[model samples]
Target chain A: MEKTVVIPTDFSIASLNIVKSYVSMQPANARLNIILLHGLHQSDSIRSLLFYSKHRMMEELCSKEFKEACYVLKNKFASQIKTMKSDLFSGFTQSAFNQYTEANNIAEVCLPVLYNPKFKNKNSFDLLPYIKASKLPVEMVGSEVDVPMPEKGKVAELFFNRVSVS
Target chain B: MKMRIQIKTTLILLTAFLSIILMFSGFVYLSVSNYSYEDFYKLLEIRAVTTAKVELDQEGGSQEMIALRNEFFEKLPQEKDRYYRISPGESFKNEAEELGVPISFFNEIVKEGKSEYTKNSMFYKGIRYKSKQGEYVVIASAQNYFELHHSAYLRRTLVFAIIAAFAFSALIALYFSRYVFRPLRKITDRVKEISSENLHLRLDNNSNNDEMSDLIGTFNNMLDRIETSFETQNNFVSNASHELRTPLTAIIGEADVTLSKIRTTDEYIETIKVILDEAETLDRKTKALLFLAQTGFNGKTQKFDKLRIDQLLWDVKETIEKINTNSRIHIDMSLLPENPVKLKIKGNEQLLHLALSNIISNACKYSNNNVVNVSIGASDQNVFIIVKDHGIGIPEKELKYIYDPFFRASNTLKYEGYGIGLPLTRNIIRIHNGEILVSSIVSQGTTVQINLPVGKFEE
Candidate 1:
């Protein structure tokens, strides 16, 4: 059975450790779906609301470093993780948060204990309070190791130079 | 040229400030002068209408009314009044000449009831009044002394302010231009001090993140490349001369010794063989040096075509077979991606062939006829070629100099090579935007890995 786990992300290199923490708790060779959730305030004006697009928001929120970090995580956990996707959460109330989790088919919520997301945009908000208020079971994972900020050099080392002599 | 930049900046600022200042001063002067002219005309018109009311309406003018008018109204400077009565269809030609007024002035009053005109500093007005008497024309003339004085004062003040503003703006523009160009001045002086002997010196970039700092950074990076190439060229020239001399010296010494003493036929044959061996070494070194120099240029004068790396590898193996008949070489292609397009790379085929052949043949030659395994593989972005040789490997200390021209491993003294092959191959690979890495354990083997970016197929 495939289980979907929702992990909060700030699109930072450090936030990717949540995936590592969650994957460590799963059974060996168990297929799982991972959702990286970022919280943002939705446009309230009528015109903007009518023209809202999730893909454009993802492009703005997911930076080059964040995208590479996601690729590295997915590749490293390809066997146990079936799919990893990014999602935007724009809810202000606890009831809306409950609906979003159910709609995404999230079976469990994994929150980082040490990580506080640094919002990249002005409209970004912290989703921890809404997730805590929801009625779903939440697992607080500790991710203490701080990944060094991935520069161009670090990203190249991860993407290329993975030569295995087999 | 440098001073012209500063002067140009100053001129631009001055022109902008001057235009704005001139416009403002001109507006003030024009408005004040217009108000003074209108005020003086209104004073004359009011006087003319009042004279008509007091003189014509009073019928020869009551003594008490005249006295009251004289007491209430202060006389203007050079004020004069004239009254004339004329019937319908009559022109005041004689009266106008006598009063120094044009005939049009009187005609205008008769037609419009009132009119005002000015000549020099004198103001005039005429009003037509009718009662029991025939139509009457009352003319009022005055010299507007107060208005003339006010206008003169305004003109003087405006000219003074404009002169002062011109000087102030010139000073400010000059100072601002100097402040903006101080950094540029320092940069020029520092640049003037640098020469080929001081290529290691770099401009300081301590300022904030701005265009000036960006320029300095770019300049320093350029210097870095220049210094590296200069050192390489200097090293190549010195090493080439020394390597060439060693072979010629050996051949010359053998020839000289053979000619100095007569010997047996066998001895003469041995001497000739030694001389011939040294000559052959000289010939090989010259050809290798020539090839190295020819391939030193990047991409220019070379034709690049889309080449399948696997096919190129096969061609290299075949070429090595023609050169070294006893060489043992095996190619492993299992690691290659299923898509043949991944193996395609845009490169000069001859250069690639030379580069790959150099490595493969060296591997077979160094390993003493042992099997050399060559593997071809590809990832999404790059194609990989790995050549493994079981031979007396390079010393760890000397591995760094392998890319230097005329640099050879200390353990490979017995092998016949001029040490130009590896550097030439590296240059060819770099032209293709590829990287080569060598790792080895002394006395065990050496593994060489080359990666080239994949090419796009033509549409």
Candidate 2:
């Protein structure tokens, strides 16, 4: 059995770095589908990149820059990527990513959202809808240094002057 | 030092005992003295009545009376216990020998009293008497009082006894205090000797399971944690060294391989280009690792100056854009505020620069030609900066371990690193007493949120 994963992104460097990390996490035999998404600011509400692409999204496919980016991704992930014209991004990136992330049997692994400050309006999470729709487990990872749990002997030092309530 | 309860109790007991002895001695001395005076007075009254009756009123003339009185007084020398004075017409004198019974008895019998009485004078205890029939006054003084001498000896002995008791109690106090505090003081000295270099050493345990034992127990638990922390730190250090060594070796080996060939300038420049890139990478990783470690050791060790965050963000973006690349990496910046979003923060500018650059570089390395978006501005209450990328998002589980030392996610090897960039960034932000947060998805992208303090506690 072959396992496939989906990567949803906002087309930013940080999000692309995440894609590289995803490439590293894949097993030797596992394959991946790089889904490049951008959410758009719909007139009334948030819409995914799928919606914006369907509506021709300010003529994104006609833009040479976008076309070139699509060509490069297609060339890089020729066997492992699926280029879609979908506005899964609510503003232009994250909302479309949220939709594909929820599609069942879509992938064995899926990336939820890669936020760019210019694209993301707020820091609060509204991903429960996506989580409920996507029946698969999501696992987040970081370098050991970014981990927040206090390691051995760290609790006392961190809370050296703390008076615990209980 | 605690007051030894036993010594205090003993002192109180000793003080009570001595007080009782002094009170009893005073009562006994007063009683004896009073009895001695009363007995002498009774004797004088009896002698005066008997002598006056026989000499003056028993059919005796004045000359015969005086001769008889003189004869009685002459016999007083044999008693060696009394002095008698017979003053005629208030002119009292000692008829036997010493005149007027020391003048003290004369004053008492004639000038101060009209009746027989006993009183104390300069050197003697005495009784005074007046005879109406002979118009004479007799004053008899005691040659020696025994109670005064006894009480004086007793007072001297008691003073010496009190001094001896105080000295003995002090010795007892010293011995008891040492006995009580020996274990505790020893443990204190032992605890002071423990340091970061040797956290494995423990407090020496005694057989006693007292309060100090509880403290030792807690300290032992702390030692367990320190051991684990040291192990983690060691792993981090080794992992960093290994990560750094790989690139360094690669850079040197690549340069060596290139130079070994006879090549033209263009070929040489091309080969050196790759080597230069590798060297740059090793340098970046090494620098990030050191910065992270330094922050870990002490946050306050670094001096902070005022920083303009808006300018810093713009500067980073400008520098990144200016770097020569194949247009593979790009940045799209936005400022929400109409103004330049001036924010004054207190922090080490160097650390801030390093942290921001590392994040931006990480974004560039993994984005596969995607754009890095950065936004910086200040809200009324806070200053915030966000760096986001459309690269791969982190796994939910691995995100928690990102800040731990030397730990990298399973997917993080694609871009070679010592895995300390984010940690370094975080530590620097924390030194400024600020916070950084993140949210990401597999392919959608990742966003890093940074909030720095503005000298909140200077007052």
Candidate 3:
């Protein structure tokens, strides 16, 4: 069965390149799909525009932000995960991933921190417990600012010699 | 005489040289020839008139009254003689001889009263006779003449013609020199062909010394400099590529291995550790490589300081002792100054220590059962340090590459090293304007020598 990852967020496309790099390195047959869902930040943006809304456009706005992020990821990927509603999808947010991990007794990748800087210093935020308990490997998505992979042989060796992991 | 430069140049100068000599010689020759002909004619005219006056004064005004006419009658200027009689009363015994006197000669002086003469001598009885009035003959002769007696002038014009031909030929020689030097076209063509790859090929500058030789020399020197820079650039790129490879491979390998399979906690941690380890190694190697590359680019930072020799060595010795309790490294400091060897050279002490420590550590590590020896002493010009080890010494060929960054000898692979230690040590020493040398033979032993400049160590 394909391994499913839930990318919960008020998603931004800033990290799309990193996702693309990951997908390229994957095995051809690997069935890795992302479950993207917008969290409460979508609600916050929606509530801010509530005065002018003639209809229930808040749901539409949240869905739009979610869909756009998914579209960017899909263009770089072979196939993508279709969004499941709140009952099955667990609303997309860091809080949702935490809830999903605890409830399902499975590891959920901690991605919510990308949405807010205010909670960054707090080590006890949503992903820490899941990371500690999870048996599977967790890959923190690299930012676009990370250096590109170099050519093989000497170039590869030189990069390794000079810029090893911190 | 040894020709001076101006003299040599004067001899070789083409312009106005032969022209001056030709003009002077031709002027002298023409003046002398003209003066001699003029003097001959004036003397002839003066003598002729004087002789006629003397005769007229002596013998009254007629030919019959002249003594020469009476003497000629007493002797009778006849056919046996080769002289002519000009008197009308004179008698001739031989009528044939009388007819032999040329009518042209008689008419020349008597009938026409003209001083004209034929070039051929007249014959009396088939024998040639001289005419006394030959001076009366007039001929336009000599190429250019002053007055009478210039018959040579018309025939001598050939001399002037020959001279003019010679001078014209000299002028042609000068023109030939100007025309033949058309080689500047070839010289410039070859010069334009020069490039970095063929900088060693220079202009064939074997021609005469002039602006062209100097120009070729300057271009050849410029090519030398360009060639050096080209080599430096080539070396930089080659070294840079070689240095960049390690870190990248580790990053990919680590990430790829982790991405391969699902693992338990311990296995996952172990895998991540390898990845992280490789990353760290890459970082270190990259830093070293960058430092080495940049150092090589401009120059090594020698910026030295006054280092307390004994104190620094003691500190190093103490530090090494702490790292390994049983390492066989013996410090023999008997020759050092009692008060701390206060040799404050302008140098980088920390880097110097790094270099020394690397050397000392290697000696200790490579030694067998024997203890490695370290010494510090000084001469008037330079400080000396010897690090000698009786260990698995390096082979002759391997010793050459010790100072090259990342060049690990094939034999030294058993010992853990990236081979950067010696290169780093060498660089540090080099920055201090110092030299480091190693001499080793298989199983025999190894000795390292260090030489530092005396007081100009600040560089």
Candidate 4:
């Protein structure tokens, strides 16, 4: 059976690296489904722009970035790749992720550890405790290096061995 | 040697402020120090993980790892970060072992997967990482030089701040003490200027209504009492001298006239009689004065016995009747309690008799009719004696002064009195812990009520 995996992103390059590192580490015979979850954190300016023409505003804000990420993910992985967006302007990201994972039959979650020098004492995201408290298996990928393109074979073997044991 | 009230209060306030400031500063210092330690430990943990990633990875050789290590070293050169790689089976030869951290501490880190602690002011964080290479324990440590320097600087600044604060507090306290006691100083100066000649001088009390004003008011009230007492003493001395000299002069004149010429037996007898009358008047006045003096003294040595108040009044009536056969003094026992104990009172019997006789005799002498009625009654706590007379009562205004020695009512000038009776009677009653109340209307009547505490019965 093909297993669906969820990756929550903040549209940062660090988050994209985590997905790339995780996907490249899968085995050859492993059948997997990948979901890229984006939570929309709309500012007042974006909200006003959306209020005028939501369809056009969304296309203008997300078209280029989303397309490039999708193209990269598709080219890197043989598994099915899907994209999802949630209106997180009203609620917490953890709740939105939980709801998306449940609806999409997500078997596991992958997150990135991104270091912020400005906030060395604070967490980059407040989602780990929520994910740990949930009934889902979770993995963390380190984003210390800025690798534009990672070796697919190396990442694939690494992730395949790690996920297979658990 | 003795601190003024303002100084004392200012010192107390300053002490309280300093105490609060010290507590708050201590809490702040502790919190900042704790946060600094936490941040240091986090940095050490990150360094440990990054070192493991760069050094232990098989795919990334020494070249890339060396470059990464250089980048890490260049970024945080001031950190003075150190690392010790220990193999579990080895003899534990490392710089960390040399740093004197117990070998058991590293063992605990390996067992628990990770541990962080501070030893000798140096933060130590150890992590056990397993890679394809081998099982390795990475112990990272650094002297928190930045935190230590920051704390030291904070300590120096706090010391200076505390000293400055104390000096400022002393200055403020001096100013506050002076400001608060300004009114008291004025009052003291004014009081010091006043002597016997300026007894009429008073403190200025028209200031803001506060405790200081209350103090000034109390002082002025005390001065008023003292001045009144002084005037009364002066008046008493003058009046007593005049009263004593009058009878003495009359007796001297009679004796001189009798001796100036030889007289017949009848004439001599008449002169002798005149002298005797003046002598008797002088003797009575002297005796009354002596008794008044005794009662005015502290009654600690006075003998007290429980005596029935009703029986004492009857004795007074009998004595007055014997002195003057025409005096009609009646003792009314209608309100007397059936229980004889209720009428009992603690007093010096002789003094009580003298007091009652004075009131009864005065009533008989001043009444239109020579009739004085004395009633005896009792309450739960006291015995009451009411002496009522249809006399030429004192004037309303003069009633207050009736208890003043030698103070006579305007209407009573026609009556023969040295004006010592009421004051003497009042003193006698007060020594026995009793109150005497007199109410009268001119040409109508006068009533004197004496209330004395009921005596406790002894077994």
Name the top lDDT candidate: 1
What would the per-residue lDDT of candidate 3 be over residues B306-352, giving only the tens digit for each residue? 76665666766764564445676776553343223224455655556
lDDT of 2 at A46: 54
CAPRI tier of model 4? incorrect
Candidates in order have lDDT scores of 0.76, 0.54, 0.49, 0.66
Tens digit per residue, CA lDDT, model 1, B306-406: 98999999987985774567998989753555567767899877668767888998899899979988877665566778787788887888889898667
Two-way DockQ contest, 1 vs 2, winner: 1
- Clash count list over all predictions: 0, 78, 48, 5
Candidate 4, which segments miss by more than 4 Å at Cα? A1-166, B1-13, B16-20, B58-77, B80-128, B135-296
In the range B348-446, model 4's lDDT, one tens digit per residue, is 777787788888888998994467777766655656677777788888888899976678999987787877767767767877878887877787677
Best by the TM-score measure: 1
Q: Can you give the lDDT of residue B217 in candidate 4?
A: 89
lDDT of 4 by residue, A1-166 (tens): 4778767644333345556567556665566676655434344576675676545544543434334334434433534333433222223656766675687787998876552312111212444455676679887776444322121211111211122100
Please tell me how candidate 1 rates in CAPRI terms. incorrect
- Fnat for each model: 0.00, 0.00, 0.00, 0.00
Candidates' chain A TM-scores:
0.82, 0.45, 0.43, 0.57
What's the lDDT for residue B420 in model 1? Answer: 67
Clashing pairs in 4: A24-A155, A24-A156, A25-A155, A25-A156, A26-A156
lDDT, candidate 3, at B168: 75
Interface RMSD of each: 9.4, 17.7, 29.8, 56.6
**Residue A94 of candidate 1: its Cα lDDT?**
87
Q: Lowest summed lDDT over 10 consecutive residues: which window, candidate 2 chain B?
A: B332-341
